[model samples]
Target: MLLPRGVPEAGRLAAFNALVRGDRATVCRAAEVPLLDQVDLLWANGWQPDDVLHHTRVALADAKQRRLVPDLVAADRAGRSTQAIDPRWQQQLDDAGLGDAQARRGWLARWSAREGLEGAQLVLAVLAVVETLRVPPLDFLLPPPGRPDQPLASAASAPDRADPVLVRVRRLLAKAESTEFEAEAATYTAKAQELITRHAIDAALLAANRGRNGEAPTMIRVRVDPPYADIKNVLLNVVAAATRCRVVVLGQVSMTAVMGTASDLAAVEALYTSLLVQGQHALAETARSAPPGARTRSASYRSAFWLAYADRLGERLREVTDHVVAGSTDSDRLLPALQSQADALDAWVTERFGTLGTSPVRGGWDAAGWTQGRLAGDTAKLATGDLRPTRRAIG
Candidate 1:
């Protein structure tokens, strides 16, 4: 078994020794185990919560003083008021890295009681704080695992290659995105989205039955590229979610690492590239109408527009997904397999980042740009087909 970083020295060495019965261990320099798992290990080995907290606090206080992210994950049911935490703590809860879901909602509620931001609002804040920590991973006494070694799957062998329906779907979206009329665009986009959604789900079921052909869950980094990397990041995130994958922006690099099965990854890349093209075109049109002297304001509006577009895409996808799911007769079998696939992909994320962290975005909203972007987003489609009359693709 692979133990994550930051385990107590004695227990870690014991586990390391256990793996030495002639079988090699593939350790990671940065992978992390769950916080509760760490907590349990400590307790089982004669350490108590008070001892755990004391050690964690001491470690965290030092990290905080050094202006580094703390390697601590607070017990979920525990109170989170900083008055009791080290007075020297500088970073707010929302800005810090904490782990993914903790098991204790009650602890979160109690922590929020003193601050008066209870329920969902407070829970979100606590989560944000937890999202920021990057606990130091335990060192591999042996050797670390190698980097992603496989070459990119060839486009010829890729999932989209033989699927002509997907080819049509892509063309429809490309046409839909370029159209002048919102109604025409929406109808084309929706139909295109519908086609892709059905295809993806169908592919998933096929893969599930094929025992996934030895394809384990994997992560692929897709570059959002820059100029408006932030805007592109938002688009990438929405596409990942729409495709049943998860994405994490890899800080200032203009790229995101997406977690999904290989098939879903292909779907995400194909759909996102097309959507991004459409989005950029829409933004260009938004820019054309910018009145003189409001350049800065117009830029802000464009930012807000893309953000709203991303938000709308998420909603639109869920609506389409629900429609697809409801219409399926085999959902009892289909849903579980899809869910199992989702859970497996999510595990890869946990192993990689330990705790996920994302910062809030601000400043995208010019009244003109906001309206245009939102309207454009509503017209954009994923894998859902809602056909209305439409002008054909432009020259």
Candidate 2:
């Protein structure tokens, strides 16, 4: 029987015969192998995780073809069985602290892809996972081939300045805010966001996975003007989270230091800038339409409206982000990488800010304005901030 260096050959022969005989239950015990041995055992048998599952499916199909349920074979060996492969897949998933299959797949695919597994290594990996899952026929649920993550901005992408995508989005937002017709403005701003997102994801996917150095972490400082700067920071958080960036508010100077790969920083920077412009316009429109009943508290009403709008926007952005991260195949690496990058950013921020603090925002609590703000936020140009761009924005 084929075996790797140092792998015991004692009961492996029985495990091998059991494998070929489609007696997974017998092999489960006879193989009595450590969970780690599962992959090596599969390799000795010239099988893969996909093959293991496929083999089971074929055997079941053949049995169904012959109109019979296959008989079970008990293990003839006394090998000690370790963790049950199938149930343990769920256990490893829980150990990783992921919520569901989609999220767990995201974590594994992303981290493994980052390491650039291929050929034999990749096959063994997927197979090792198969042993853990233990449900032979269920291997079809294994994750799809993972793609590398979006790289950090590098000199290759841009020449010591802003990315063209960022510039383009900024231009579109500027046009959107400056234009008179609401429909035309929405179209421009929406397109800008779509373009930037596409540019970021596409560039990451098309590049060679090996020897990629574009993931160097970096920072960008974004300005937040006062009179509701705290609220602005919340809005910035929305963009930052969506773009895979971490934000630190510079309380004293009304500035935000965003940290992430350059590609992400560009997206966060431009998206926040555009959103700020759109938000500014929306707030002004809401404030202008306020009736005289709250005349003395008009300023408070404006502040209230802004705060309320930020609250609504934050909720919406969080929902959108969660959905995207969960559903995306490309995000497997990004999901974990984001956490690591965030930790790095937190360390960087802590060194400077020491003890971070929050400011109290003044009134702007007009119910009418708050309602209008919710409507505005929900119907914003890029609704879920999804990966693909919408064909056109609603007027």
Q: Residue 362 in candidate 2 has what lDDT?
A: 54
For candidate 1, the clash count comes to 25
The clash count of every prediction, one per candidate, is 25, 15
Candidate 1 TM-score, true structure as reference:
0.54
- The models' CA-based lDDT, in order, is 0.54, 0.49
lDDT of 2 by residue, 160-224 (tens): 24566667766776776776655456556556655655554554444324424235556656667
Best by lDDT: 1
Best by TM-score: 1
Q: For every model shown, what is its TM-score relative to the native structure? A: 0.54, 0.47
Error of 1 at 160 (Å): 5.1
